[model samples]
Target: MTASRFLDVIVGVVRQHLPAGVSTRDLDGFMDRNRGLMESHIQRQLGGLLARLPGPGSASAEDPELPELWTAAKRTAANLAAMVVAAKLGAERRNPTAQERATLRGYSGWGGLSIEGAASKFPEGFPVPEARGLIHEYYTPSKVAAEIARAVRDLLPTLTGEEGVIHALEPSAGIGRMLSAFSGLGFEDLIWHAAEWSELSGRMLRALYPKLDLYQGPFERWIRERGPNWTGRLHLIVSNPPYGARGAAVAEDPDREYREKRAYAYFLRRALDLLAPSGLGVFLIPSGFLTARTGEMLTLREKVLRRHHLAAAFRLPSVKPGGREALFPGAMLVTDLLFFRARGGELPEVDTADRGILEGSYYREFPRHILGRELGQDAGDDDQTKKPRWGYQVEGEFSRLPRLVERPICAECRITPLLKELDPKLARNLRMGVMRTSLDLDGDALAPISPAPPRSGSAWTATWRSCRPARPRSPPSSGASCTRRCAPG
Candidate 1:
């Protein structure tokens, strides 16, 4: 029989044997109890098929058609075994756990691929496996993965109850490291599911977490097939989704008019759509999500603010000592760990402060009420000059986190008129092109001012003021020091 026919037969056998009135819990228990017996039955059936078609079309047969028939038999046998495993697991509505997965692996070798030096055994024109997408193959740092897991663990209690099975999904589960992190946390009866686009990574993940509800292929296609039932079913969603690129077509959001459809944006939107009303989502996303003015990025931000309760944003370091990048290694990518929850009951309050700096790292909370304040029309009316970076600030610092301010003074724009507006004289002096200060990489003190391009990756502005320094005075409270005034350059 063909692979499809074999699969149909296996599924039929499972359906015929399934007991009526069995609850999902009971079904799961039943499958576990009968695993050995189920394996034996499948083995026996496979053995029968093999006996009838052993070595397909004997070597003595001169017909060319005989070899093709032989290939089909071999293909059907492997496919049939895999189908049996899938059918049994489907009956229980659960995936094979590690041990159960290993048991199933015994049925097939090379995962449908011919073993090395065994290629002559199969058809000559067998298709080669497609190459995996480079965007989907990016590696997530171990420290970042552990940190995200910890954050998810802290947020889980807020979104779910203590008992019963809770489902968690990793949309881009390369190598299953994130899944392993969740498993290590010891959450009672948690179900791990993943969707990986790379065949190689998916294989690795499947090998590492055999019982994973794994989907191998583009996440977008998998979402389309499985999404309808996933609505409000997932308790937690965590991922370091692909960035910078676009994926399979996504229906335009008529309401948001989102123009940019980068892969990471789609992944985030899908994750949110799949999240239960009380679910928590933790993502390692580009820092630009907070500040990018592109229609798609803005639309995504607005959607997040309006739909979810923003909990905390942990701004991770983009650069490291010895002039190396942290998140993307050879490339510079400023990243943030965002933890948010779908709107439900009251969200817990946190202690934060305005423009707070904690050990050179930035952390902020985004309460729902003030979420769109920064994006509001009035907030940007004064400048009309688009500021490239923006972030939120919590009401207090460290001790008592309370309210949140949607737009806080960004470090790069501190010396700009935006921050000194309250003091018209100072704002005027700064905007008039005053003292220019360039960064001194070796020292903390303000070096001599000159007109030059700012050092790459350094926050220091090459020209602070267009004219000569008037004099040194205790810097204004606006945080711009080395006060001076000069004519516009």
Candidate 2:
């Protein structure tokens, strides 16, 4: 069941049926585009084509990258849809109304080794979990997990009783590192649901987050089969989905832009479909999703912008070379923490420079060194005044609610971007007054009503920018001025 072995067999079998001179590469693209659909048909009609192919052979038991699980993976396709369809019918959605946000204080739990601490139960020689087609399994760091949880907390509705019980889903829960962030946040009535393909990872996750509604299978299957049941109904989705895997299928966003085989892109496109209209999604994906120049990636970006408002974005440094860094323990895959809200973000001008901050050009490049320097002048190191500490540490650079441009989040809610703490504990769930935001919208666009908006959890420094009208009738006095109203996105 090795990928190369199976690939050769599948390709050889398909070649016999190839029409005319269409090369395998061309057919490869065609198959890749329709892989999801093909897999669906195979799941239902497994006997015809699959039965002809050879079954898996005995392989080394000690293989780190074991192919033994590949046989089980193929068998999963047959019952994947049945498994999701037979699961608890339609997913219940949770939405709350009108909450205020007093203070958005940041949390400091990075030192806890949240990712490592949760996986402390795994034995030293535990085999890598690849049964779920997971080629990349980097755990989310605690600092990153807390930041994602903080963003999710902002968009949550303050529902009580049955409605208050938040129905949440994490597409991939490796040992519950990200799931634990949901705890201690005021949302005590959270119903956790997660899908992990590896039995080993599932066992570890179950031990860590007892409340999780665990789905032990590939995310593509669970999301594709169960997504419709929860279509536009889930309150929140937080995940650090797998990266760089192929042959994923999803019923949602069947278009090629959404179907590109990049595992992160495929997972995000489908998972996003299940988000409640006012729900929030916070994911950690490769920066390529944000910066890739490919046409498919570009289309995916546009699709996201058209539907959801890009709220907050942070580009995390990749793992330092030589693997001594304590952050991400996998490949040097530069990642970004992206927060998307149902609505109410300033639209960015495509192809334009800094005007549209979310535009690819704005984030065309990022610092790649390990992030060790604390943000802002508050970092009390004696050499803080020194310039170009490049070799010393990499500064964290991010922006939150950085939507101040030609079009504001309506005129009333438009306030100066202030540097504030991120810990929600310091503040009440404050809601800004309801106001109609004016963004280029189609028929279904709702006036963006946002909560205590999510802020850039990792900002190198905060500068005051005015959100006043383009042409001010009267300039404010020097001492007290409304000029420094908002911060740059």
Candidate 3:
């Protein structure tokens, strides 16, 4: 039988004999018990086909056609195992029980490839393995990881004085995806270090990095106990840390306190502390880090934003798969390399004007390009500009975080000349309307009352009339008529 036919037969037999509601392990055990019979069937069918063609010693099996058949047979066998596992897992729901997970983990070794040897195995291609069993999560697509790595690599030379050996660290390295990209960038003798909390994942990383220095434990505990030793040593750090919120600890401990902070924030603070005087760091962080109002987020921003200048941020197109809702929208956050420099170190003088640094603006409007698009608006009134007359200026000419953080004020408050002509009560209502629609009050109001100040034109009368309560109106000629109209129904 051909490989497809052979697979069909095995699948048919499995479907016929598979126990109802059988656990994955039990199904695997059933297959194992029948292994001899299955192999015999496969070998007999393949042997007959080989006989019809040339023998291995003869020209038939040696023919290119025969080799393809042999390769297909191996592929089919692998696919058969995968299909069986998938079907069994689907039937069971949660990942197979611990025994099944362990069994699958061990069986994974049968079809594994070395990460370093990947390029050679598929000489004409990028060698990313197919998602298999539990190893799927560890695999970061090479194309995406390479793009992020290149962005970091471009910034690293500036931070490292153009020609120094750079020591990089990835806290949750998982199968070395980011590290592989780092190695490709020509860092001399890259001292790759990683930590894996999962026992199976740790084994996989060790296998991939035989000589690599690795620590296997919960990241927070590892950092609290061991991080100080590496302080002032690392030159670069990058990571795609875990996404789930840290759970309440079983016991009250300092390490639990460490984990209580979002892992990425903790890693960021740690990277800043560990970095060499002239080091650089890039992180893949949730976009919430930019606009978060929580105390932890505010504190994190206060510390990093003041010290580390924001170099670049790429708001990536959503690449997360479905069912992974907890994974926050990610952006590539690049911070200046100078943040790690020692006090009074010889540093390059940055032109505040040329670099586009100013109060109430961010660097996002600079000439920096991303994914082939220029950083900011082109010619027309782009979305970023144009603040509401009743609201604080939303978009400034420059791009910087510090410039944008401002408390909302009633537009009619007479503390400033700008606020003197506007109606504070009307502005407050408009602000409330903006908040109700989940829009920013700074500029993009959902229900804009008036295009400009009410005093600008006769159009303001219609706008004012629209906002008036639905109760009875007073006589038109008196100013009291306007006041009574403005009162809430």
TM-score of each: 0.45, 0.47, 0.41
Off by over 4 Å in 1: 1-136, 161-163, 249-260, 294-296, 344-489
- Of 2 and 3, the candidate ranking higher by lDDT: 2
Error of 2 at 150 (Å): 3.5
Which RMSD values do the candidates have, in order?
A: 23.9, 24.6, 27.8
Candidate 3 lDDT tens digits, 1-489? 233324333443454355678654575567557856766777676867734542111122123332112243353343334334434554445455545432332212212233343324321221233334122232333334444553444344434422355666777775555665565323443466677665445544454344667887656655656664554456677776653344342132253323434555665655554554435566655444543345555555555543344545543322222322111112112112111221111112232331233221333553232222222232211111122122211121211111111211122211101111135554454444434443232211123333444442111223244433332121111111122122111
Worst 10 residues of 1 by lDDT: 376-385
Residue ranges of candidate 3 with Cα displaced over 4 Å: 1-140, 155-164, 247-260, 293-296, 319-489
| Candidate 2 TM-score over all chains jointly | 0.47
Model 1, span 1-489: residue lDDT tens:
222223323432343345688543465466557756765666566756633431211111112232112343463354334434544554556667755553333322232233434444333233222323321233555445544553354334444533456778888886555665564323544687789876545654554455679988777666668764565567788888877556444542332333345667777866765665547777877656754445554545655554454556654544444333233433334555666665421111121332222211233333342221232121111111122234222121111112212232112211221211113343344334334433332222232222342222111222333412343231222223321122000
Clashes of each: 15, 21, 9
